[model samples]
Target: MKKTVVVGMSGGVDSAVAAATLVEQGYHVQGVTLQTWEPEDNATTSKKWQERGCCKIGLARFVAQRLSIPHQVLDIRERFRSAVVEDFIGGYSAGLTPNPCVRCNERVKFGCLMEAARDLGADYVATGHYARLLSGGTRGPHLHKGGDPRKDQSYFLYRLSRAWLPRILFPVGGLRKEDVWPKAEAIGLPADEVKESQEICFVTKG
Candidate 1:
């Protein structure tokens, strides 16, 4: 029987390629995009939000369709606001610098996606994060730096529960950033149409 994996697709090239690669590997892949924030009703604000780093539901669905896999959006806006956004504000107000990405990864992204995976009877939860997992060791699965040093995302994943390590997958972790683009292009994804955003999804530029 093929193992089922619920992939967190962020509508970006890396995630699109991740889902495609897993499907090619014969896993039953389901693409899921987390709606972590509420966009403003205005068209200009909505357009700006879409240009950010997260919640590209339309593009995510398109990628899923191209891969011939199932896709769905999981709304976790309230949870994100409380766990990540509010926490970020609190931290800043307290004179501490907080990395919202790290908090989101730990409290919202992996946490919520893992729950969804279980509800779907999935064997594992996967993401496009550029980090590697090393297993078969005396200490069990350990998270390691991805193959691409420049794009390594292990730092953002440090807060993940150790127990969930074995059930998590990083499909694009071994590929370099440049290599990921070619894979995205090969899969017929609109590589040029999607630009990678470096800013926080909920925080707009002034």
Candidate 2:
């Protein structure tokens, strides 16, 4: 039986390429997008909210259809609010600068999504994060910096439990950000058509 993988696609080039690569490598791949927030939540904030990336919601479905893979949008808004957003807000009240990405990766991505993958009988849960995983050794699994130092996301991923490392896949970690474009295009993916995702996906302003 082919091993199955549930890819957390954000509708970006890197994730698009990651899913495509895993499919090319003969793994049974399914794309999942976690919808963590709503525009109405930030409606009264500012004009920056207008810049929120709609691609995150729509494009993932587009990419999945293009790649001929099953796709689903998981509504994680309540979970994200308690696990990441509220934690981030509480951190500010306590005068601590919380890294929500780290929290999301540890709590939401690997934690929640991993369980989802297991329910689907998937052997692994993959993401487009720019960090590599070294597995199949006596030392267990090790997470390493990506090939592109400039875009290395190891820091955000350090909070992930060591146990989950074995089941995690970072398919694009070995390729530089620039290299992902061509690979994405090679798969007939609309890599350049979508605008780049914002730095902070949850917050509209810095």
Candidate 3:
């Protein structure tokens, strides 16, 4: 039986290519975009959302169409806001610098979305995160640097469950940025040249 891999698609080039590569490798792939923020639809936030990329919500549909895979949008805004954003604000208020992305990886990325992936009958959840989860059910899930040291995101992913190690795939973990570009271009994604973002998606620039 083919394993069903639910990919956490962010509508970005790396994730888009990751899902494509999974398809080429013969996994039963589905794209699930976690809607982490309840957008205000105001001009300012709307402009920022446009600038940062839509997480490929609608574009995930397009990518699914292009790859002939299943796609779903899972709304995790309230959950993320409660867990990550609240912690961030509280931390900042207390004079501590909080890492929302790390909290988000623990709460939103792993906490909320992983449950959804299981509910959808997926055997595993995958993403384009640059961190690698090695050690396969040992050391409570060892999160480490990606093969591409330049883009490794392990620092933000140390809180994941060790049990989920075998089930998560970082398709772009080993590949450098230069290697990822052609895959995006070949897959016809729209954001080959878009700048990668920093800070939490909801945390606005000053």
Candidate 4:
């Protein structure tokens, strides 16, 4: 039987290609988008929210449909607000800078997504994060920098629980950023329509 994986789709080219790569590798892939926040009433805020790569639920669904795989949304807004947003606010208020992305990766992405994967009877949880995992030593799986130095995301994931390492997968870790676009386009992912965003999903810029 094929191993089952629940991929965290951010509705961006990287994640879309990640799921597609795993599918081609013969894994039973299920796409999951984490709803971390709700759009505000302000038109500007709503529009900005939709433009973010991470908040594109509609695009994620479209990618999943194109892949002919199951897709679902997991709402974790309350948790995100408490763990990441509140922490960020409190940190700044206290004259300290806190990185919400790191906290989210530790508390929500790996923590919550791992649980969701288990609930779905998935053998592993995957993401488009540009990081690599090396296994086979007595120490178990080790997280390393992705092959693409420009896109390496290992720093953001440094705080992930070591216990989750072996069960995690980064399908696009070895692919170059430039190479991913072609793969996305090849798989009918509407590559031209998808724009990359560096902004935080829950935070809107002025």
- The candidate maximizing lDDT is 1
- Local accuracy of candidate 2 as per-residue lDDT tens digits, 1-206: 89999999876778889999999999999898888876343433223223354226566666788889999888888988899889999998999998888888888767867988988989999999899987758979898999999889899999899888889999999889888989878866655455666465677765
* C-alpha lDDT of residue 183 in model 4: 94
Candidate 4 lDDT, 74-177, residue by residue in tens: 88889888999899999989999888888999987788879889899999999999999988599898989999999999999999999999999999999899
Q: lDDT (CA) for every model shown?
A: 0.88, 0.81, 0.76, 0.86
TM-score of each model, paired residue for residue? 0.93, 0.88, 0.88, 0.92
Cα lDDT, model 3, residue 122: 84
Candidate 3 lDDT score at position 169: 87
User: Which pairs, if any, clash in model 4?
Assistant: none
Which pairs clash in the backbone of model 2? none
Scanning candidate 4 in windows of ten residues, the lowest lDDT window is 40-49
* Candidate numbers sorted by lDDT from highest down: 1, 4, 2, 3
How big is the positional error of residue 143 in model 2, measured in Å on the Cα after superposition?
0.7
Clash pairs, candidate 3, are 10-55, 140-162, 141-162
Off by over 4 Å in 2: 39-55
Tens digits of lDDT, candidate 3, 19-119: 99899989999888887765333435334324563364655666778889988887777777799888899999999998888888876777655787779
Model 4 root-mean-square deviation = 2.8
Which stretches in model 1 have alpha-carbon errors above 4 Å? 39-50
Which ten contiguous residues of candidate 1 have the minimum total lDDT?
40-49
RMSD to truth, every model: 2.3, 4.0, 3.0, 2.8
Clashes of each: 0, 0, 3, 0
